[model samples]
Target: MTTVTLPEKTPAHTGRTPGRPGRRGVQPLALNIVALAAGLGGWALLSLLGFEDLPGPAQVAARGGEMIADGTLLDDVAASLRRVFSGFALGTLLAIPVGFLMGWYGVARGLIEPYVQFFRTIPPLAVIPLAIVLLGIGETPKIFVIFLAAFLSSVVATYQGVIDVDKTLINAARVLGASDLTVFVKVVIPASAPFILVGMRIGLGSAWGTLVAAELIAAQEGLGFRMQQAQLYYDLSTIFVGLITIGLLGLAMDRLLLLAERRLTGWQERR
Candidate 1:
């Protein structure tokens, strides 16, 4: 008599590895917490070592708490947020169309590229004097400089994205009878989305970097202005507070953009 062996059944794959559902989400948050703790620890250590002009984490936190209780912090935050958002939005909105034009049309590129490159060489800070002279010492100048910063950052990124789109994909779309508009809408835009989002993120940073100078245009009631005032009185703690507030705000906004990028470019592969 012969003994017959039967094949064992295997589990079907569901395209995802078996693990705790929230583990991946929790990991990044945990790492971020650790990083924050490490930074605070280093800062505290440095302050303890008598680093002149450097306020410790505890001192800064206490000052921040007082500002928060007085509602001064909130007001400054609101003002700064308003300026950054307004300028950044306008810059990005205009940049997308202009960048698309420059990338998609040779004639448009010829006309616009020269000016774009010209402006790119000049720092937004350099424009401040002119902005104040022309737009006056008002909110207009502050917002204008910020707008220029964001516009330059975003336009360059957007133009690069458009040009960097895969030629093969465009050709294939064309061969499949897709019209130019259709190809642009269906193929080019999606392919270029990652770069555009990255550019927007860079633009956001540039806007914040320009904020201190932007608020210097004979204005008041913002973080940068607060920091400047603090500087006059040698209020290191307040200066630290303003610096930290701006950093936190920028970090939060950048994280939001990062989330948007992840959602929009879900089709792209990653490590």
Candidate 2:
């Protein structure tokens, strides 16, 4: 009894460290902001060094404002956006069902794989002539070009995603009493969403480029048409303006897809 002793317990805060929530996140973002500012500053300096061909950000911004005021820019942007969305929607809608069929059905896969691969190798630009020949120089050919862009990319991605889905997961679903349709709907589709989205992003970019090519061939509207007009007049500034606008628009659309991807795939990190 006299020799009995108890060890002292440590206090909860004795050697504990405190953390600033989200502090790690802020630093990289701050560095990125600084880098962006420095890059813009360097661009401005370069523009001031007699680089007349290199349209400064300010010049592009001014031209953008002028175009907006004249209403042409907005109209072109809207028209281009509409074409992209419409074609993308049509392509993706078809691709999803077809991809699912090709992935799940052996006979369907054998039947469709060759055609899919054949068309996939053909460049969208190369197919422009074919599209025009088949559909004419109107919106049909243009949309078809965009549709091909989306279809090839999205379908391939969806097919690959479906094929690569974990067999274990499928087996687990089956063991849990999921019917084929239920398993596909509840598991396969959700699992393949990321790949499908990536395809959509690639497809959208392709569609934008294809839209420019499409507009180059007998079109009187859109940014590409405006740029062509500017080129004919030797208006380098206006051409640069249109080029920059196209880039900005593409960037905006890409960012929108990225945002959607982040939201849709939020659960990915937890895994």
Pairs with steric clashes in candidate 2: none
RMSD of each: 3.8, 4.4
lDDT of 1 by residue, 138-206 (tens): 789999999999999999988999999999999999999999999999998899899899999999999
Off by over 4 Å in 2: 1-32
Q: What is the TM-score of each candidate against the true structure?
A: 0.89, 0.85
Candidate 1 deviant stretches above 4 angstroms: 1-26
| Error of model 1, residue 107, in angstroms | 0.8
> Cα lDDT of all candidates, in order?
0.92, 0.83
Model 1 Cα shift for residue 194 (angstroms): 0.6
Cα lDDT, model 1, residue 190:
92
Number of clashes in every candidate structure? 0, 0
